[model samples]
Target: PAAALDTLARSLPVSPAGSAVAIAQDRAREKAHFVQCGVPVAPHAVIETAAQLAAVPADLLPGILKTARMGYDGKGQVRVATPAELAGAWEQLGRVPCVLEKMLPLAHECSVIVARGRDGTVVHLPVQRNLHRDGILAVTEVYEGNLPPAQTSQALAAAKSVADGLNYVGVLCVEFFVLQEGTLVVNEIAPRPHNSGHYSQNACDVSQFELQVRCMTGLPLVQPRLHSPAIMLNLLGDLWFTGDQPVAPTPPAWDAVLALPGCHLHLYGKVEAKRGRKMGHLNITGTTPEAVRTTALQAAALLGIAPF
Candidate 1:
């Protein structure tokens, strides 16, 4: 669909995004593009059918297989801990086109967002430290010096190289896996503003969303400045229910959250509250990172997300 959409965005000459070229260089194709452009990514194999499982190289075992399209939040993925599991995992995914990527030992995960114009100008924001739960974004933290300086610089440089290669226009997010040995491996690519960038809305002078709109309109791209340290806690539908196996959905009390100073709550107005749904997010900002993190823990505890 991304290829189709990219092609569609190409034929329409009237769009304000200056032809909308390279709005998305999707995951499956982006890997090849990255390798060609000298960007480093994890060892992977493209499996289009179940029979291809037998051909998987021995070294790439203990990997994860993912559907090439429409998969998100840990869905459409199966863990292949051993070679024998490959056949069952293939059948589980219904023999769809998938990418078998070897899972790397991680020190932490982070992301860098790039906004590019048709003229090839690029803009980047402060890298964000991301935490995930059940394969969904659980929290985002934006603070100076919290991440390893070497790894941060490496991710930024790699992201810019990829963006330059694609001639990408619009906001593009590159997620990275920092290995235990301190190597940066490109994990995936999101074609637009991503969950990790949402913290910029409260901490930076120019948000990723604003940058996206600017790029699409052919506006001048500016270097984003961070004004405050902040933490963004994702409010998922699980909070609305009592527990994992929730029998009835009940909204949690919002008083503690609303009462906290410097806490900003943004809820998506969705009618249903089914489990795993992203209901909203809470952004907490402060003059310092410690203050921001302390208040965020308090907020999380108040929402019953932590034992405290």
Candidate 2:
């Protein structure tokens, strides 16, 4: 697809050039790029052959073996606890080129979304605190003080460095892991608007979608300001089922959900509902962080989502 986009960009302008796409598509290249940009990343090895697999360092065990390409939402990944599991994990992945990364102790996960312009100007949304369920994004919280001052500054700087390193020209998301020891390490990158940034739709003056258009059309990119504290809860297809063994899918109590103040729901027009599939998201914004959290919790209770 990058090849096709590269060809198309020859005559028409493209927001994100193919080179950036290529790097984000491969985990090995992504990690290399992060390191080149002076961002810390997890220790890992690329195993494409038996010799390389066998040569993996002992310390890297209890790691995650992930395919270098086409992996998302925890797919194409296997958690290997020891060297003995590496071979089978690789086999399970169909012997594809993979990156084995030492799993680090994490206190929490957060992400930053930056929009870069052709003139090299970069503006970012506030850092987002994220929660993942079953490897899929479950919730995103964005507000002042959601993260510590030092970690916020660090994540913002690293995200900008990555965008500038690629000479990137679009909305890009960089995810990071906050270690228990207060260290920060880059996890991955997404070349377009990300699920974590979805809260910007209602919480910011300029949404990521509009920012993407600006970057593509050579329009001026303005720094987006958060107008209110916000929380976004991902609505998964699992909500469509009620009982433990339901015979048919049932819609949630949207009327009750909408009755809550500051509750905004956006549903994707998917024809079928399957377990683990993303159906929509609920964004709650309010004048105060306390109010937003309370309303969001009530919304979650109504939707059967566990409290944060």
Candidate 3:
């Protein structure tokens, strides 16, 4: 799907100025583009060949080897604990064009969804705290109280900065890494609705999808406002598997999950589920973080989701 999206996007009529090259489509290009726009990012090296991998500097050791494109949910990536692992990583990733990024200590991960009109007007969603398992998003907690005011301000400014720099005309999402020392670095940018913003459908005055429609159709952009504290759990295909095998998965007990208060369910309607596939999500809204977590935990147990 990632490859398909890229091909489809590239086939459309594009701007000669490179504005159509959305950073979200390619990690290597995104990092370079962010740097060109004066945004801070993790230190990394881009290598396009096995020779480059063999010559990688020792300092970037304990780094991650990532493909430049079509990598998502932690797929097409490998972790190298030392310089010696670089060659092995290159071999592991099939000697593709890639980035070797020093793994930084992260305090947490968060994402900000920014909507910009064709006229340059912009607005952002409430910052959301995210939890991931095996490179796939597991949960997103959102509310004004979920994120510290200062960090929220920083994340919003950073997201908007990239959107403005690209002269982006639709909903754009920026995933940020909050280091242990409290600095924020851009992880990547997405040109459309993101998993982290799914809670907005039930918890915000304006969802990212709605804003995207408005942006693309020349309508005025509306500032999104959070209506509740919410938590969203991504339902991946692993839930359908029996044990670790790919056998037909036991259908999740939908009735038990829906019985929870303020719990909303969304299924993608795909006929077959396979490993790492995104099937749907559960969004739980409540008056407080504790309440959101409590309700979401109940639904997770029913849906067979791993605990956050």
Cα lDDT, all candidates: 0.81, 0.94, 0.83
Best by TM-score: 2
Tens digit of lDDT per residue, candidate 1, span 68-144?
A: 77678888989998877877888888987788999889888889988888788888999888888889888888888
Model 1 CA lDDT for position 209: 91
> In candidate 1, where is summed lDDT lowest over 10 consecutive residues?
13-22
Per-residue lDDT of model 3, residues 1-308, tens digit only: 44454565576622212443445667877898889878789999999966777777777878988999888889889998976677877877888789989899999999999888877899888998998889888999987667678788888888888888888878788998999988888898777789999999999999988988888777888898898899999998878875865476666888888888999898999998877899999889988888988999888887777777
Q: Which ten residues in a row have the lowest lDDT in candidate 3?
A: 13-22
- Which number leads on lDDT? 2
Clashing pairs in 1: none
lDDT of model 2 at position 212: 93
TM-score of each predicted structure versus truth = 0.91, 0.98, 0.91
Candidate 1, residue 213: how far the Cα is off, in Å: 1.1
> Residue 260 of candidate 2: its Cα lDDT?
98
